[model samples]
Target chain A: MAAIRPGALDPARPLAAVPPGDPGDPGLAESVARCLNDFFTARRGAADPTDPRFDGEVVARLERFTLLGGKRIRPTFAWWGWRAGGGPGSGPGAAAALRAVSALELIQSCALIQDDVMDGSPTRRGQPALHREYAEAHRSGSLRGSPRRYGESVAVLAGDLALAWADDMLDDALDGTDRRARVRAPWRAMRTEMIAGQFLDLHAQAQADVSEPTALRVARLKTAAYSVERPLEFGAALAGAGSGAVAALRSYGSDVGTAYQLRDDLLGVYGDPAATGKPIGDDIREGKPTLLLAIGLRRARERGDPAAADTLRGAVGDPGLTDADVRAVGALLDDLAARSAVEAHMRALLDSGLAHLAGAPFAATARDALTALAGHAVARLR
Target chain B: MAAIRPGALDPARPLAAVPPGDPGDPGLAESVARCLNDFFTARRGAADPTDPRFDGEVVARLERFTLLGGKRIRPTFAWWGWRAGGGPGSGPGAAAALRAVSALELIQSCALIQDDVMDGSPTRRGQPALHREYAEAHRSGSLRGSPRRYGESVAVLAGDLALAWADDMLDDALDGTDRRARVRAPWRAMRTEMIAGQFLDLHAQAQADVSEPTALRVARLKTAAYSVERPLEFGAALAGAGSGAVAALRSYGSDVGTAYQLRDDLLGVYGDPAATGKPIGDDIREGKPTLLLAIGLRRARERGDPAAADTLRGAVGDPGLTDADVRAVGALLDDLAARSAVEAHMRALLDSGLAHLAGAPFAATARDALTALAGHAVARLR
Candidate 1:
């Protein structure tokens, strides 16, 4: 949490990246990875044999999924957030901060696993999703019953365990800190908000919502606040950030987070599978009721192109969609300029978020790192 | 947690009830209800409109499910365990103690919601289960997509929230206490054990497991300890119970807990729907791979009753099983003496559990209350 002083990270430099290997950020990422490695190693060995409840396979699967390469965006953002609150950038206290921030990854694991199951996603991070892996095992004759159901049950339990274990990990970070309640307050809020947001997203899909506001709200709740804002708050709270700083982070984080989700929505429609680790048009097939679809639909009908609108509608949620069908839908959206419209929207939001950091009382390194993170959040093609 | 003492609730008493309206237990129940009522009321008001994330329906559904009639067995046992550790039976401290104990209900709520969804259970407590209610809503036109999928998604989020919220509630109980870590140690263990047990049970079903030891292991994980033993530990820890007291309570609780599940499995087959608030032969319909079924199958084969064993197997896990099918299986099981055999096993477990409590270091009134609870656990029709 930092004061939202009016000025930009460089009002002239619109989300420009500094190439790869940014100095401190890479170390931050490495620290989080190391923390996760240790956590999993400890867990893998701690499986009790006397207690049949401690299944070896569950531990292995969980470890595999956790290490399957996420961008570690949350922890990166949290590190800067803590630094913004005057936490140590490196040295003795940094490990504890890093450990605390890594918890977001565990929580993310929970969300991703459950979300994949809910979406019926076949793959994640370019590999079979957790449920699909389990289903495959069942199909391989290792188990009975409906393979799909067994797979899903396993996924659900795995996700629940991740959430519980996330708290346990956070406990390690907060131990003897005398700030457990303070730190836990935001962490608890973040958990509830994420779940609620997920429910909303599901409800929107269920009701086939087309309202842009509703979709934006869903994105903000499910992605923006949960992915960006809350992680920032968690780190801030961990640093005992003051109310002023917390409010600044709230405004700056939400705006940037909104930009992040807007970019994600675009990626769902246009990003390459290799880069995104998801199939093109999968969201369309799932009828996600995302902002992109909402904008495309509304704009097409507004232009008196009923047939174009029809073509877009035809591909919105067609599970049987062919590659050709997806391209045609993509072409129509391109024709409507909907993609650029969203891109412009995202750019403006990101710029506005960066503008808030002007004159803020942050260490120079934190400011530079946050600026870099802002670039990644907004401009990353992946 | 309590030490495993060697005495009985009274082996010769035959589960004799102490009449209706037992003195202190009803008050304990009321106190828990009051805590839950307040928690829900606050949650209901906190649903912010600006955030589409929070849904009125979600909160209402969770509240309805939580309050809809559970035996509150865990909280009661926990309270006694606490009393056995010198926690007050009544007064101001009782409220805080009760709050901690009642968190178990929230955990139970999570387990029930997810379990129902996983089992595709149509009803719970003689009412439509959570997923069923949501699916029915979809069928009635308020939502779209696969009704079952939407319903399950909602139930999963609901359950996840219950767990997260349970921790939040526990935080309130442990607020400002120096003993937070001490109490949390057992709470964490209980949480992990119960989840592992659920997974084990699910795994058993998928494997079509028949080993009696494996079945018992699953029960111990899934039901006995979660429902009885850990709750006692939670209460004892809250009361600062010594290791000896904790160990004694653990023994008394687990044995009684084991009997509780054994009786439950029998009731699933033979208990009246009116009394149990569940349909008869439900376990068979769901293919739960219960201990009773394992015993029946093994005994039928051993007794040169392959035909009876076949008949029982035919009924096992038949989702479309008819009343006639259930009756035929029941008859075969009766012929194989599996039902009586399980009843005998349950009685033996109960007697042994009561035996442990005889020398437990509990106050006289706590002893009386626990004795009554033990009777209720094993012999109650429901």
Candidate 2:
């Protein structure tokens, strides 16, 4: 109940002291879902429908959208991070830990919804994006104002609600003073970094600052830090993990997380559309300044292929860009040795990150899970 | 430092036991300003400019917009509420209360910025709206992407940061466990209601649900609850006020807060543009579904003035509305008896609220302060 001392936490015997999660990964995911469901049910019970403070439609949409399908990657990472930091590994203890970590999913939902709105993206995960969904509803209902504006407005509130609700859930999950105090820094840092990263991304797009350094900074803050590094750190903090284990997790998270973004950028540009659920080379049309684009541009300029470099410039960020133009851009990237260069970089990051995991100060199975996750995350770098 | 006993807090004696605030209202405002300044300065020092996480332009704009002029109404209410519940009235005690309560202002900034964006208002308090300011910056710089989109994106992040930073300030301001626990519920509810209120506002515009009940509901949630009731409750809670005092504050807050909205509605339609910093009758052009509008429509209908009703309809929600049209609409509201009806209603609410304060369980001077604030808040009704 008091403030935790770093030396008092048993970071050495983490997962080794307990059995594997009884229901394991799938069961952990189910527990997280159940926790979320119970939380929302309690909220629904407490709120009066006629209060105007909570509109039925808004609540329903938020509930449905958040609970719907997506890989629960962040929550899984957080759970593993806790296990890596000497948390009890099974039974109700495991359930409570899962509940706390599940909060990350809600924050992720907020991030994705806001990101989609900011990008003017119409779809996400093969479905209408949150803003688009609300906009369509407005149109269908024959609402008075501009459907787009109304949709965007409500989506903003919905995204904000997701964030506030996540905080509420985390408050409910943390039972003691030590846990709350320890988690506060990482929790604050995670939200701050994500929001700042969003601004940086927008700034990059506005300024067209496409250096590899700029690209990696965006990847680190927006993707790596927000998605991977912070979640692990937060979970470790919640478990009152020692500095050594925390450092190892951060090291592994930073490298593997950056690799994930590099691989994602590659997929956005050249991976199969059916497999990735996105149109190949769509990033070129949107003119998103990913590392893949940075690598291509660098190689083209370095090799003194002026024609290829010019073509790449013309293709990327062109409003009137066509599928044929994307195909041409893809060919140019392949010819310029740009694609292989990024692939090599991703490989190096994953290798380095996995080596850290091997020497990480955690019990056996959790370390193995993180190593496997790193490989799976960057497996798309074909 | 133990859990507060409500009776031990002495909600009845309130401000009478303490000397006149060593720094009174003006000094309290100054302290709030200083606290905010210190917080932001620390944040600036801690952030590395070289790190992409802190965009200099974004940080600077957030600081400027937050520090710029406003009445600081919410913070004042919170401070007085604390005093009314027997918090120390002056010295370091006053300073601590002000620091914690001033967080409401940052939240206010977030609300105003987001409201301006949602309403697509070009200006706020005689300056460019946050989104418009960012858009202007983009255009002046001849940024690569859509200026409007970039502006909106950055504004969203800025507003979010304000909310998060406010939490950080509040976290620092709380010195003990009991105060933290006391503040959590009201804090959570305040944010929840404000966000919900925003949605209700947007919904009203979208649905064109001009029923008086709908309008009243919007006022209650968006204005009465968010801007008034919750802030008072939050402060009293922080001071460990008994439930009796809490209930009385809520009763007084509800009535006075609704009157405040009524006055605001009146100003929107017919008040001096120079004083209000808004164009006269601008709400009519936008067809904002205020209770004033609802009353006008109902009066026109009840009086069998179909032509007047039709004229009113044609006047409101017109994008190309001219100055002459606003004058004509003003004349129509007068003829329909709608303007006086709203004025009479405002008076009744204020009178009823003042009566509640007279019986409220607080010190006589605290009671006097509430009475004066009520008058000041509704002074524009004329």
Candidate 3:
């Protein structure tokens, strides 16, 4: 991937136009990128003057990894959330708000980097994962310890740095603002909930839990809270929104976030690989206890289809599953009407979330942006 | 390994007596322990009511691990540093100071737990390391996927939680205080420096660089800064000390902290295993590029003793080194006068640190306590 030129990422650039009706703010993306670049430049300068290797190994790579790719969806949502809470769109206050929301990307950076280590993913965003890159460096340098261990250790430290930096950024953004207390609550909650949700996700997989409630809980905590609800609440809180507005945004975020994950669950099985940039059926092969699989399994058992139930149980977690096996499972799910059920469930969630937004006392533009974002979230690849 | 009863730890208990002229404070230990227990209790209460497993797995284990065993050296130093900065020994402010200093233990928790994961150590503080405990649970439960991976992942999450909780504690302790900004700067710097130090350590190990400067740099960054200097600065900062006092305390901490590590290096090879609770000669076996080894190698070469130099190079870091090999290395080091040189260096560092303390304007009791602490640190196992 080509390196991003820091100079080109100007924070003062005009907001990019949203194409026709899709949810976007290219200007927000550029400004967040600029903010991250400036932060990293300062951090690099602050690195131990006695040890130049530190800047090279940790900070530079972190900057490159962060700048390389991400849709900046979290920041976008936060922006709309702030707007809905009556935050201005332009001014020093707006700039600070942008800085605060941009911090979400750093948090995202921490999550993805650490998750790659946990999952042993070799690549991210079409490039070598941070750990893998470090491991390769170790191997080339003839390091003494296990290369893999060194790589993972380095990656963990890198992730820790990112997490710490995210906090620093948020603190800087809230420096002179009276919203520190209000903003901090959700920020703290978001961090803990994300980790907790990750733990639960791991636990569910370990226990082979297929219950609908467990699946929904993981989705709500891991995806909804970290990806949507908390970000919305964080923005609303930063704007000093009243309780009713914060509550409405939170509820709306919860529904939309769950719906978004449900859509992802479907795409994991059936979306075009080229479009999704993920292998179709990989989730099934891993036997992830997604809501789709949970519902399908329940329906199969409830219908007294022993063959289908047995096949589903045997094939879901089989690492050696072939394309034929995935096709069979898909066929079984369709026959049980699990696909239709999940699709219908997803739509209902979206509708309910939109209704909450409709009744909320928010700026008209923010309301429209949020509606578009929610629709775009669930309607992807539809 | 007996579990500490929370009720038995009272923050308001009278200060325990110290051995004549020894740096000690049993009351401080009790207060810190009580503060931690109270924090954990509240955190447990705040765990999702819908997910008790999260509390059981993450928070409870972290609490048990933290409360189990530690000399609480960091907090002790921090307390003295605060006192030296004119902080009262008893009052609501003192209580807040205790709370803030207690945060160092949590940061230590993060470091140690993650260190074990990186080093692949199976035990710590006379108990199974956190990762090992979780790995065993996975093994016994016959969980899907790699038990080792799951355990490490869980440990990583637990460490992340500890890090976040430490920040929360510090923030709480500084709430509504004018010292928030002052305290935050060192707190932020400490966190980053610790992680940077860790990265540099791994880099040194990977490259097998045995230069004196590299070894000293690693010692200063990895141990001195995190274990001593930063904690002292954090306390002094929290007390809003003047630049001269903070600078004096920081300088004192630097010398004493490095001396402490040098002494530790000696103990790693020569101290009584029973007394230190560590295997003697393990450092040589692992070929750790300690200052002792660095000095020994340099002296051997300077003396034109090819045999001594070759043996030193070959025996150090040889995993399969026998007792005889260790004995030979020790004899050679003594022959080269490396041990005497390191001893003299350590004493000089301690004296220099104490002199800095003596010249600084500080409370009488605090100065005395710091002097004792410096002596205790470098004179260990003497």
Candidate 4:
């Protein structure tokens, strides 16, 4: 498949082109780009011609999605974690370690593809999401079958394939150790936690009685583990970082991960649709049982407004809901202070995560990178 | 879900449990059992509580199928390949390597699950196949969707999950190696080849001009790469086997894999329904573009008996095909010498595989295992 060069909207610019401090300094951004390129090239080579294995549409979506310009926070986290744990910035081993970080980005892509399908999302990074793209392809007679189901099935298979590729990439990343069991622990944990968390998220959506605490718990397990703890700890573990360092990184990761999801909850409601690349009031339309939603429900129940309860319940997932209805629901959410509560939660989590990072044995550069990641993960209303 | 134990099938007498080096080698049997238990126990633990994962069905089937038995050729091949490449049998690494071999069983299960779904097969191992079982479940309940589609979807998901897990297991196996790139090469190649082969098979079936040679090529690429060459080479690679050893093993694996599929083709036509756990003439009913089918078509064309061709085409995949139609098709297949030709192919492959194994560095005991596997793969008539 031909590569989809990132358009002007690509996230790679901010993340992939960070300026080096000096000629003598290692260009981390360049390293990340090279690592990503190599990983993707390997993946393409892995495509067997005998299999009607490659769907051009799916491939285009993945290339576009993966190449989207965001700060390579996860990969940077992995790199920094390794560096902090006494791994050097050069040599074959270090290069492999960095490639391992690149693998995390691919895994992230897999997650987003499946998550978009499950959420019935329409847009990603200012473009129609994978399923939407495939659906359009079907509409245009570019492919045949039940478009919606085809989109879902293809996305599912693509995600599965990507997930497998990530492991293969990681297998190419670890070097110079007999610590196979120890190194495998975090990868295994990451996969297990992510899947478990996804199930919890699904279950929470299905059940009507989800509480704030329950929702938060799901977020921590599902989002936090993969987004922060596992990636950091996996890199750290691979570098033979001691248990103490791993424990500290875990604490830091968990806090940042929780805050990350809380910020996402806030964005799901009030963030600008243009910037977020999703429809305004999408979460409400989808009836996502987020922290904000739980908060709104609790407040409405306390006020004993049965009418408010009916309105909220009826409006959730009602795609035909009027803009006025959307505004009204947004007003109710704000009035209930749900948005403020989420902001406060985010602040607490950021503070806790940063505090945990204090006194860790990581290099100053890595510490800075982690702080930058936390800041970006919860960046304000934009 | 509660553990679904295998029904009364004695593990010791399983179809594939040909004990080597004295049937009285209780120690070896104990070691094998211990290895199997530890392998599965760890696999079960690998499931995360958060993911609504595949309900341990892969592991469950692995346990049931491996325990119910056929000749344990693949695992033995893997173990011997490792040992022949200079890996010692006493260390923790050895155990890990053995566990890796056991994972091939899961991969095989995955292949079988997907193949059965593709074939629209109703039974496996004297019971309703997974898809059929799920379909039956939906029928017996007040399910709210298309039961067949749901069954297919679930089975597809299950197979996908198993495939993902297989890579995960292999990744775990290759951890802490400096030869990460080398170790991962075969895995990456295997995945690509298998998926490509599947596509080729599908494409061949859909086309009217598929030939015997083309169909055979598809089988070899799709089934052979993973089943024989990849598994053996993956183990050998991990044990630091030289390129020569890897090449030799590949040659051996290719021949054996081709023979294995040839035997499968024969069984699909002529095997007893009770023994095969499928309805008689399943391949005929499915219109599988097998080598046998292609040959039969050619023979019928030469004889100018368009009636046989018409009957064969009409009956293939026709759910309403009668016993008489099945008999006619079977007779036609035999008249074309399809059965005998396939049997000859199997014999040639076995001979070639064993010949390739000759003068290799494998242990005498391991060589015996390989020979046994070759025999067992083609032992149906016996």
TM-score of every candidate's chain A: 0.91, 0.90, 0.90, 0.85
TM-score of chain A of 4: 0.85
For DockQ, the strongest prediction is 3
Q: List the candidates ranked by TM-score, beginning with the highest.
A: 1, 2, 3, 4
What does candidate 1's lDDT look like per residue over B92-200, in tens digits? 6777888888888888898999999888888988899999888888889766689999999989988998888888788887787765787776777777776788788
Tell me what TM-score chain B of candidate 2 gets against the true chain B.
0.91
Candidate 2 vs. true structure, TM-score: 0.92
Question: How do the residues A303-361 of candidate 4 rate in per-residue lDDT, one tens digit apiece?
Answer: 89778777787876566876677778878888877777778888888888888778788
What is the C-alpha lDDT profile of model 2 across B210-309, one tens digit per residue? 6788878888888888877888888898889999888888888888888888888887777777777777776777667777778889998898989988
> Per-residue lDDT of A244-355 in model 2, one digit per residue for the tens?
8989888888888888888878877776666566666666766677887888889988898898788888776676777667777877787887888888888898888877
Every candidate's chain B TM-score: 0.91, 0.91, 0.90, 0.82
The better candidate by DockQ, 2 or 3, is 3
DockQ of each: 0.57, 0.51, 0.61, 0.23
Q: What are the Cα lDDT values of the candidates?
A: 0.76, 0.75, 0.79, 0.65
Query: What lDDT tens digits, residue by residue, belong to model 3 across residues B1-382?
Result: 1122333232122122121122334477777888899888887888756368998988899999888647677887788879888888887898899999998888889888998898676677657889999999999999888889889999998988888888888888878887778887678877887788888877877787777898889889877887788888989988888888999999999999998888888877776656565556767766666898999999999999999889988876677787667777888898899999888888888888988887798977778777766766554333
- Count backbone clashes in candidate 4: 17
Chain B TM-score of candidate 4 stands at 0.82
Per TM-score, the best of the predicted structures is 1
Tens digit of lDDT per residue, candidate 1, span A214-261? 878888887778878888888888888887777677777888898888
lDDT of 3 by residue, A235-333 (tens): 998888899999999999999899878887887776665656555676676666788889888998999988888888887667788777787788788
Answer with 1 or 3, whichever has the higher DockQ: 3
